[model samples]
Target: MSGIPGANRQAPKPDAEGAGSAALGPRPATLARYLTIYAALWKNSVTREMMFKGNFLLWIVVELLWFALQLSFIGVIYLHTNRIGTWTQWQVVLLIGASHFIQQIYQAFFLINCTNLSELVRNGKLDFLLLLPVNTRFVVSLRQVDLGAFLNAATAIAVMAYAARQLHLVLTAGHVLTFLALCLVGVWIHYSLMFLLATTSFWTIRAQGIVWGYYNLFQIARLPDEAFRGVFRAVFTFALPMLLVSNVPVRVLADKLDSSRLPLLLVGMGVACGLVSEWVWRLSLRHYTSASS
Candidate 1:
């Protein structure tokens, strides 16, 4: 017999102390690791989209046509009047460009991935995502990209540049930086709202209706902020804040914002929405019943 009982048997099980230490000691993925993973994901998405070259080109053409039509409509409106709610043709064009920039970037980076979350939950694919050693929110937000939408964003930037030139608006470095920051804040607001809506899938197996409703509501943001008044203004300005999404950035660029604190308020609102969305997502995860279960 061996000196120890079952000496040739399987290796000894970890002791309680050792197991507890191991359980508590593993480090989470670092920020750099997360960025690396996201880069890989984006590379794969671009590859997949490129594989369907015809479809990609078709989408690009369709988006360009739609944008052109929007510009034509704006031209018609300006034909009858010199200004719409104190916004000149060029200023309103700038606003439209800003709206398109925000919308296209949101769609390219976050919309598709976030919308798919409901499907992942419905089919229990989210379980695999949960098992991955990464930040669930970050992974969920950036697993895909729409190259065509990025092309549209570039077009919007060109339009804004043209409008700035036409208006003879001198854009300082500070003005440009502030506009870009506010544009990002607009994107964050859109993502936060969409994520919150998608998380409703935890309770309602198919929450696409809510997503569509959000699209309908957000369309109002495409118009100039001065176009709304009274209850409409109060509702979109304070309650939902769709107006603030593109309007604040446009105002900042146009040098039309009267109050210095308006930008701060916009930043605060975006941060508050993002934080609330995160909390709601965690709460929804707790309520989620995996398809396997």
Candidate 2:
């Protein structure tokens, strides 16, 4: 809105020199314009990342080590017992891999942007971003991309492949596609919840602790949902829905759908979370007091 000039004015009369080109070329649609903007943002991010190749590579190694620690924790549990709540070792590995993949995808695309919301608000940097000629939420939620996090997600995929082999799971094209799709659903659930937490910055001085706290909650996602009991299970599976994220997709691959309705429930939860996050973001914008004001 701020970039567009003379919204009420008619199209300007073209000079004879460029009249033919102006008449033949149509204006880009709104969605197309936004897509182009997002592409440019990604390009800039990639360019900046190239300038810090060492840092990028270092982060990838650190994440891989972190993932190894998680797998080691699972291995320790398996040494004591073969299964945790009806899930075999390989099945649990697959679930943890799915959780890691979802978490990385969310981190790569959205986490840094959402986390920056608080800093933007604190320093009044958000005022300029809000004035950009695009949806405020879109600008805030997708201005940065972390290639390291995205590349690190490949480790999870490799682990999942090994687990699938151990479980003797059939890997049909349809099955693989469904698994990936469900993983994306898991990512959406994370993005929505994290975005909601980040929006708390509109009221508080800083909400990074709250947002990072939510990141720590992903540990629960890697565990078997059945291991949780009573109110704890109920709250995570439905209220927060964190347990459903990786568990649902892993169950589908392992042919362990306890209820035929689990998939439907997971999809419904993703949609509900997305809608709630959007509504809350718009509401929070109204409360934002720019630095100048």
Candidate 3:
């Protein structure tokens, strides 16, 4: 339960006599206002997730195992050849850690509801979203927020920082800004991919295999894009390309991408992917002949 705007507590809706007029502010008049609903809805979601506190602890355990595996992956690769690719051990570690950080933003900030959205569409709960006062896209994408995954994100920064220090990397404003830009693009690309996957539910009732397989692609996110060469890189570089979004951010720090130089090209790719994803989402909406009245 959420508080009536003027009510003293967080419980939903109060009597007019106790909480003043029942009428709340008119529907959000601007995009910014409607976007705020994401935050409000997220707060409610946080409460819901917290109610199952055991699951939160289990998530933390899973996150620990996840981080350990990625780190150990880099370790094993280094032992085999001292460097499986051009990157030194530290560079590879930084890439792995940075990938985790980026992955967290996607999972925590955007992918939560979108990934599971197919269920709502299949079950007919989606019709209710269409009738809500908020923007349907916003409502659908942010129906919930998962904060448990954020622990992985938080731990990842520490890993990234340690790796950066080992490599003698120093941070600069230009690097930071370029990284932020790439991160935004990366988040969008990630969400867009998930959105496109969820949209399949509009036509099909089951897509669990499709969703799981797509997510498994993130395992490749920790590697430098250049490690993929020849036809493999060509295929991944554009078609189903996780490389452009993940490795691009790592390169921002490694300076494979010169911030002083072609910053526009890197971000342009992100924007392009995001736009295509949004277009696909809208197209899916057009096909949504609701399962329920």
Candidate 4:
């Protein structure tokens, strides 16, 4: 394993100075170290975002406009039909809000960082990431944050809340908590899939096209799962499992859990994808040849 070019390597010892002292402290427990690193990265990301006020505001405006357009489209569809599949106007809006929330959360935290893996591999920047003391995957996935996307996430939450109120869906504390948990599972599924795609750069040297294609496929999840049938439904539900991301959470919120097994199925799929992605990443690492070589 150690012989592999990009295999896990011990972090170099810090110099006697203060810089290394902070990172080299008697290695903290794994979870503690990971949390500490994530916190620091999040702080740095917020600080950096603040330094570029114009860009930050621009992205926020663009995201708002995009979400508004989605809502307008939904309104237009409702004008023609009372419901989409089994979902009513407000219910479908809830699903759309859930989708945006999960997508933005993933984008804010993991997408930017993971997408950079290809660039890192192509330009040899991955050398530094591989040498970090922490788990390489953790470092690569959580190293950056998008503050603007975080704001959009908040907007999505507000949309969900408003939609729920409009629908008169009585949401208890348990319902809210469960919905949030399932949303996190949805984000995990997305992260697992996208991370897997990004790792392909290790072999292809350029996998952006594949990444974009995956994103396009993910758009299907924004619609109600019941809108598809037969083979198309099976492909997304079992193979890609994108539909389950937003659909399951929205169903749970709407108290439409007649399919008692759906939650377990969604969770099982997420765990499966996560494990497979991790395996693929390790395999990619073993196959990696540094750019300088």
User: Candidate 2's residue-wise lDDT over 100-205, tens digit each?
Assistant: 9999998988899989999999899988876654556777778899989877798899999999999999878877887888888888889888999999999997
Off by over 4 Å in 4: 1-28
Query: Candidate order by TM-score, highest to lowest?
Result: 4, 2, 1, 3
Q: TM-scores, in order shown? A: 0.89, 0.89, 0.85, 0.89
Better of 1 and 3 by lDDT: 1
Q: Report the lDDT tens digits of candidate 1 across residue range 1-293.
A: 11111111211222334334434654242334445776898899989998999999999999889888878889999999998888899998998899889999999988888789989999999888776645466667778988889999999999999999998998999999999989988888888889899999889987978887888865687788888889998988776788899989999999989997768877888877876887788788778778988
lDDT at position 219, candidate 3: 79
What digit string (tens of lDDT, one per residue) describes model 4 on residues 127-199? 8877665557767777889988888999999999999999899899998898888898888889889999999
Residue pairs with backbone overlap in model 4 = none
Ranking by lDDT: 2, 4, 1, 3
lDDT of 1: 0.80
- The model with the greater TM-score, 3 or 4, is 4
lDDT of 3: 0.70
Q: Which candidate do you rate higher for TM-score, 1 or 3?
A: 1
TM-score of 2: 0.89
